[model samples]
Target chain A: MIPLGYYIGLSAILFTIGVVGVLTLRNAIVIFMSVELMLNSVNLSLIAFSAYSGNPAGQILVFFVIAVAAAESAVGLAIIIALFRNKLTVNIDEVNILKW
Target chain B: MNLEQIAFLILAVAAIASAILMITRRNPVTSALFLVFNFFIIAVLYLFLRAQFIAIIQITVYAGAIMVLFLFVIMLLNLGDDKLLKWKLNSAKTISVLLGIALLVEVSYFVLHFTSTEGMSPNAESIGTVESIGKVLYLNYLFPFEVTSVLLLAAIVGAIFLAKKKFE
Candidate 1:
């Protein structure tokens, strides 16, 4: 059996990459993708703990998380499409009309 | 170093590499494709962890449904290669990279130092199967399951409302 620490370490690395992507990337869709990456990393950790602790609650929580992520991405992409129709660009820096 | 360990290493490397490529690529479509690949690798990792139901759901929902939606939006926008050549090593990028490194070091330190006192349950193998997940999900988590369905419905309506063309 693989050590649980290895799984946790992998999850952390992936989460950090997702954070970096969100911080550095300017495209709205890519940022959204990075958010999904973060969510997946969290899911991986949950499953790792589930496997290690032999609990079903963590897996069930992962199910809920996947459902929530799917819904979030649907609405988020729709909003992105709406934004694109108005701005004709997906760059985050250029979509600062509401900023002071 | 057994087969499982080797498999875990391979999948972990593939997932991290694909995620990095996904974030770094300039073309949104290319990035989306790499994200799909990353999702697949993650699904396989779930399988290795013996969470078969989640593995299947990860493949179907993430790689299949979510990626398709992303691709559709990418093509709909018809984004060109204009943004591809604009890569810059700005202050935000530098700071974020440093912060990300810090986050990785901190997390790995915790992961390596911490040890679990409780042993895995003897029934760990049986808990992750599809039937067991279904039983627990329907019995104990039925309310959340119903709420998820409602949430999905709301998302569908919201997507339609947001994306519809306005007729004035």
Candidate 2:
């Protein structure tokens, strides 16, 4: 069996990458994708813990995470679309104004 | 390392590569595709970890639905050839990258130092199956499950309200 540390290490690396993406990327949609990446990495760690511990709790948490991620994405994308329609720009840099 | 560890090695390499590709791509569509590929790799990794049900849901929910939604949003926006836009790596980018690296190092140090030597539990192999998971989820997590439905409904309403052409 592979060591749990390996999985957690991988998850950490992936999470770092996602953080970099969110910090550097200007596109809102791309930023959203990066957030999803971070979430997935966290899920990896959770599953690894659950599998090693033989606890179903972690798996259930991942399930809820996935479900909430789904709902969050649906609403998040809609918000992005709405923001796009109003401002005509998806670049996070330019959409600075809160009120028109 | 046996066959499974070797497989995990290869998949980890591939997953990291695809994840990097996903972020580096200028076009959001390409990024979405790479993210989908990364999700598939993670699903396989789940299978190797003995998480059978989670692996299936990882593929179905993440690679299947969320990514398709991302692709749709990308296409609808038509933010074509984002490379043409000037994307300079300012001090913020540098700081962020530095911070990310630092975070990775910190987490890795902890993981390496605190390697759990405990043996796997007896039911560890079968614990990830749908049958076992369902028993716990339906019994213990039932309230949360119902709340999740309410949360989803609220998300649906909120999405429609936000996206409506003219909100009254």
Candidate 3:
């Protein structure tokens, strides 16, 4: 049977993949994309929960999440670009000038 | 499993596989492209859940707009050959893996315990339709909606500030 559990399981797995990406990937932009993936995965779970629980509030939360994700991507990419210009590199390991 | 279940399973597998490729692939652009495919598969999954509005928004916002932004920046910076794999798992990796295991256990527990009340409900039809969602979204949730817009504005300002080379 097609169950909500299946959707929830898939969502959880996808979110885990995104988390793995964020923790492992070195490129700044790549990490940002992983963050986006994590956000999308969370949205999937939220909407699924909303559909199953008869709550419209979850869908509204999804709307807010999408808007915020867009904004985050913009600012994050800009920061990455600025860092790239400063170091001529996009690798996070090398851009640790602020590190003691 | 039924046909719908099979289909969803296939899509889920595809999306996860591509996500794996996204993080592991050496080329950054390829990784971004894989992410775009992952988004498409996710949008299809959303359709299966009967959230037509969300599926459309997923395509438009994630597949259409955000991906293009990533591609534009990647191309603008000419980071085509920026592929260098970092060896050894950092502490963050260990923590993330543990977190994933915990999430899996929790979700599986809920799945095994809770019985689904069947597919989409009759009321769901009217509640989340484009018309109704818009009505409630703008009326009852008007304050939070406006606040979200302000957040977007701030993000845009932040982006411009970060992208600029100098303050003067």
Q: lDDT value for candidate 2?
A: 0.89
Q: Report, to 2 decimal places, the DockQ of model 3.
A: 0.61
Report the candidate with higher TM-score, 1 versus 2.
2
Model 3 C-alpha lDDT per residue in residues B67-144, reported as the tens digit of each score: 999999988888865546453577877787787678678777876787775876546655566876788799889999
DockQ of 2: 0.74
In order of appearance, the predictions have TM-scores of 0.95, 0.95, 0.90
Candidate 1: where is the Cα deviation over 4 Å? Answer: B117-120, B165-168
How well does candidate 3 match the true structure, expressed as C-alpha RMSD? 2.3
Write the residue-wise lDDT of candidate 1 on B100-139 in tens digits.
9998998888988977655445676788899999999999
Candidate order, TM-score descending: 2, 1, 3
- Give model 1 RMSD, 1 decimal: 1.8
Which candidate do you rate higher for TM-score, 1 or 3?
Answer: 1
What residue pairs clash in candidate 1, if any at all?
A: none
Q: What does fnat come to for each candidate?
A: 0.74, 0.75, 0.57
Cand. 2 TM to true fold: 0.95
Inter-residue clash pairs, candidate 3: none
Write the residue-wise lDDT of candidate 2 on B61-124 in tens digits.
9999999999988898898867533457889888988998898888888988976866556687
